[model samples]
Target: GREAEGDIQKGQKEKEEKEKGREDQEAAAGASLGEEAPCSRGALLSPSRKAWNPGPAESKLELHPLLNRWALWFFKNDHSRTWQDNLQLVTKFDTVEDFWAMYSNIQLASKLSSGCDYALFKDGIEPMWEDSRNKRGGRWLVSLAKQQRHSELDHLWLETLLCLIGESFEEHSREVCGAVINIRTKRDKIAVWTREAENQEGVLHIGRVYKERLGLSTKTVIGYQAHADTASKSSSLAKNKFVV
Candidate 1:
């Protein structure tokens, strides 16, 4: 028993060390992200040696990897194209620096033309209501007024991105599958999609943390609607399963 306890302690220590190293790498990347190429997914994945150098023994470039590989999807409601064809995979990134690099290069949420959306989902999960990972899940939806688009849309979307990549939901992080921001003509929306809408506790916890991260007004209320619900009915008609 004592030997087993020692082994567990050693494992925990190793985990802590690994986490520390990851943070250090992310910090280094943040400091030098300005040098990265714009619109280069390759740069996001394979940062050049000129941008990072941790030590003589290590590789010329090392980046801080995230817990989950995420793919960014862009959707423009192109009337000429089918929905699937309209949605394009912009890029995928699994490192803090890559996320920052790609994000910096892209247009802000407020700047996206109406009927366009930006979605970041874990690799292998499609950013659609019909996606297997999303079909059973729901989203905590934050609807913004037309005016708020100019004032608050970009900031809130950035915060939502940071929350997902940072895993800010703690024990409920895995429940969060992805997030989306839609730019519309009159009203805009941002939603954090979770894996299981039936997991009331986990879903609610994510809602609370997400709302807090967005720095929403305490009087404001947001709603969570399952994909099953939203898929069957128009979003305006879907009933909220939960709210925060």
Candidate 2:
């Protein structure tokens, strides 16, 4: 409850400041302040904090630091509303504890109805083809048969989210954009999107790490497809550029 309250407070403060900054920039010839202020970045990004402690009560909880802040989004399909309108921001967190709190409180991916999607992306990056961060990226897709939806969907989705937030890929982790779980009628799909399609080495490394983390069988095959291809061709017919 405390963690959830802290997240709500943080989100509200950030939203208000963003709105105010936008208005101020519009009045000041359209040059907006960057997302991370200089002083804040210096404090947040510094390596010195690794050794700092906030004393006893805080020390009781082991703080797991993440490489980046991530935003969780939910898309509830509605025939009466546009796609963008149905997509809503749930919350954002940069720590392992907060992530677990949010994940445990929300409905599992398996419980979501067909046409719904859960996307976890880097903060400030929207989970869509239109977002500049995702425009050039591609996804490593794991398609599940309809029969597997009830049994494996939720587990796989949670594993994927943990892999991303935990920086499990080591050096190649920086190339990861986010992961998505799309609930569909015929099949449910889980994909991990990376920022560059052309970086074959990094892409493959990420894929290997992802597959290993999920404990996927050697018989199972997953494909990687560039966003450019998915954007032009229908998703159902999109060709795979790489497979492992």
Candidate 3:
């Protein structure tokens, strides 16, 4: 769940670039930029269609495929509409080249207006807590200071996305559902949502891999918060169930 934002002024919630910017976030100990992300994996193999062809020669380009299909969702905090109504599906991709095409084309996280969000979830799962796959799960939350929004937000967000499509968690990847980035007026946040909160070994392993993949420096810590706890709270902040 999220804090009540209906009272937030409309002017403040306007998107940075309606056709460009929007995504979501939080802070953590430290992390890498994941420059070497293997974005090869995506979802189902697309059916051959002339509409997908770029041109005569390049049309035959073999795209690197991902292990799973993923969907990108966008949310605009609108006081007039229900939260569910504001969420929209942007697109779906399952190939490395396609993912990059989409990524490069979209607005960077830092450019999004306040209250806008971007969620990259496995094809079948929604990025909200009510989904069956996420109901009992929790997220590895990373909170970012306001200043870091301009400096680290884009790099960290890209790394987090790479970690997802690249399947960085090894055996624990199956337990992962999706990730969300919230661009708020105050502190920004990025969270990786998993299917189970009680899977200690798996959850902790994911946290470690995430931190390592992001190339986080030692000393700082990131926390994990269950969806149930977050949903029931009246505030955006939730108690940490685990930390790494």
Candidate 4:
């Protein structure tokens, strides 16, 4: 017991020493004779007793701000349960760092099981067709073959996300609602949904920008379909209102 207590004390001392070293570095970075440098409260307090507080230069990581906060949803298919029951909210993130952190931790789009789906929508909006913000919207669909998943799914998904966060659609960016990636047995689908399907200029612009960003071949045809049509269709087919 005494040895264990001694070990604990040694660990605490080492921790305190490391902390003091960090504070000293911060102080050296923050100290400037004629200039005010930014320092955290802890850094400032740590070296108050020292005659010379030389804080280490602040190594602040500049985080890029996204145009909007996005929520990521995951749907794991369960034949015994309703579709709504299978859909679950994974997480919501607003900053660039948080987005990447979440993205890196999750299973890659290509690796997900068939019948699963990943949806990223602006905060406060659900990814379902019935959501008020999405009811009037339509998605620019990019259907990828099963083979493409191994080669292109993850890259395409990242591009779609960048388009959303970067506001790459120009003036039409405001019309953008979110994006979705559906993992299916036959084909994997990636779609960027916008708020108004009827906004021809915005919809087409979003589609062109999206398709170009994904580097889709000219021979590859992508379609845009209204949610209304998608919702009412009995078959898995919906009429394409526009194509690019």
All models, RMSD in angstroms = 8.7, 13.9, 14.8, 14.5
Give the top-scoring candidate (lDDT). 1
C-alpha lDDT values of all predictions: 0.77, 0.75, 0.74, 0.74
lDDT-wise, the better of 2 and 3 is 2
TM-score of each: 0.77, 0.75, 0.76, 0.74
Per-structure clash totals for the candidates: 0, 0, 29, 13
Across 29-102, the per-residue lDDT of candidate 4 in tens digits comes to 35332223222222221212222332322223233346578899999999999988998999998755466557
Root mean square deviation (Cα) for candidate 1: 8.7
Worst 10 residues of 2 by lDDT: 1-10
* Model 4, runs deviating above 4 Å: 1-59, 234-236
Query: Model 2, stretches more than 4 Å misplaced?
Result: 1-62
Q: Write the per-residue lDDT of candidate 1 for residues 44-158, one digit (tens) a residue.
A: 3332322442322122334556778999999999999999999999999987666866886788889899999999999999998888888899999999999998898888888
Q: What is the lDDT of residue 155 in candidate 4?
A: 87
Candidate 1, superposed: residue stretches over 4 Å from native? 1-61
How far does residue 180 in candidate 3 sit from its true spot (Å)? Answer: 0.5
